[model samples]
Target: MFHWLEKHPFFFAVGVFVTIAFAGLIEIVPNFAQASQPVIGTKPYTTLQLAGRHVYIKNSCNACHSQLIRPFKAETDRYGDYSLSGEYAFDRPFLWGSKRTGPDLHRVGNYRTTDWHENHMKDPVSVVPGSIMPGYPWLFENEADVETAYAEQLTVKNVFSVPYNTPLPMKDGSKVTVVLADTLSDAQASALEEAKLVAADMKDKSVQDAVAAGKIPEIVALIAYMNSLK
Candidate 1:
């Protein structure tokens, strides 16, 4: 068979291509699947965090910031650790931006606080001197679409099995369970409760008042989402 194939270059080339392709698939597929599983400590986003993710996408924050951190000295030094594929297992549509106009936020929740995000969203320059990013004053005024966020949670939970109610392991050897309310009203109430926690750390009166009134402003949701990045 080897001698016969050598006599015909076309067949030989085809045989070689098939052999290589099969070898590549065998080597790649299993590793890819394993790497794509959620990391030991990774958890699904809560209702408020998911709502904030909607706001983040709605405002095109992904256009300026990237969630991926490359395995490089400079990137790791600035953006915490390098990103792992398992870390994004729960993200329905990954936000690994192509270009970074601002900075990587995969670990921003570790370094940045609620108050810092509040001030930065209201006035970017106030928090970071000489920041070119524009203030998103409208986020503070607009009411967060909690209903829509809840709808997405249901879709992902039912269709994708995101494990919202399941207990997830953490790096510190603890477990955390993200609740996905069975009803829309319950979800909204839970989101409001989470928003109040974020509002407590913020100095913005309007944001605080809105959460107090049982209304979630976009800023609060956005902050919750931002804080969950870690």
Candidate 2:
């Protein structure tokens, strides 16, 4: 086979391409499989969180913030740990922003509380002095698209097998289950319940009223999404 192939330059090039392609596949396939698995303790987003994510996107939050934290001491000190692919297994169209105009928010949920996010979103300068970020007063007034978020949940659950409603392994050897609703009404109810919990920590009366009226405002959803970053 080698003697005949060496005699033909075109055939030799084709063989070389095939050999390289096979080697590339061999190297990539295993890592892709492992990286796509959910990291231990990495939970899927709840219904409200998904809605909040939509709010984040609609507001173009990704343009200023990044979700990825590099593996460096400076980055680790400021942000949290280095990012892992498995940790984003459940994130559909991950918010791994291309630039860091503000800061990495991959673990913002870990440090910031609901009240803090509420205050910050209302007025970024209120919480962080000299902040260039503008306030999002509109988020408190606008409604979130819970329907789209629910659709996303269903798609990821069915297509990616995200382990929704199934026990997922944790770092402490415990298993937690993330339930994806079977119906739109159920998803809406669950999202409202979650929004209420988030609203409980906020001091804004308007936001409180919105949740009371069975509505999920953009601010509520945005906070929920931020809180899920951890």
Candidate 3:
């Protein structure tokens, strides 16, 4: 069978191509016809959460940590439910990624606390002695250029929901305008608003704790974002 397939390589290749094309087209037809395409759930981030996501991305955390869990029996047994498609509604270019150097963080939200998170960030070894994770002390030292970088995040939210037009007021009183929605459906708007409020409360408490401790890092925002997973 191998020798005959090699001798007729072009024909075999063409046949394989045709079969794949037919399968691909069939799979996409339903997707294209759906009226309500899945919208990823996203809400405006509090300053801290936005900063955290930036930290996560800038550090190339994706290089080691995937945000997805497989639905196979073994994966479900190990990581809980197979990741829900709806759960990732807010992720763009979804982080349901390819590598697994550490572990699936789909539910890391419930696993640790702020102080514990800070220790891990400051020196992974202090928390997990055998951890291969790199410490992110730069997060402790660097002052994020809050105005310019965070403005871009508002732009993205505007694109997703027209009612997201409310501008975030910076501490300096400058307003960041968003273009997404003037009025989201009641449910969508409520959910987004609730998420923002919760994130804000978390940021305030985290920052207060850091200040009280005096050993705190500047990027409590990033920590809040990490804790928001799932």
TM-score of every prediction relative to native: 0.91, 0.95, 0.60
TM-score ranking of the models: 2, 1, 3
Given candidate 2, what's the lDDT at residue 81? 89
lDDT (Cα, tens digit) per residue for candidate 1, span 1-230:
99999999999999999999999999999999999999988998888898899999999999999999999999999989899999999897999999999999999999999989888988899979999999999999999999888998899889999989898999999999989898999999999999999999999888888889999999999999998898
Runs of candidate 3 exceeding 4 Å displacement: 1-44, 162-218
C-alpha lDDT values of all predictions:
0.92, 0.90, 0.59
For model 2 the local lDDT of residue 173 reads 100
Error of 1 at 171 (Å): 0.5
Rank list by lDDT? 1, 2, 3
Clashing pairs in 2: 52-221
| Backbone clash count for every predicted candidate, in the order shown | 0, 1, 15
The alpha-carbon deviation from the true structure for residue 118 of candidate 2, after best TM-score superposition, in angstroms, is: 1.0
lDDT of 2: 0.90
Query: What shift in Å separates residue 215 of candidate 3 from its native position after superposition?
Result: 14
* Model 2 vs. true fold: TM: 0.95
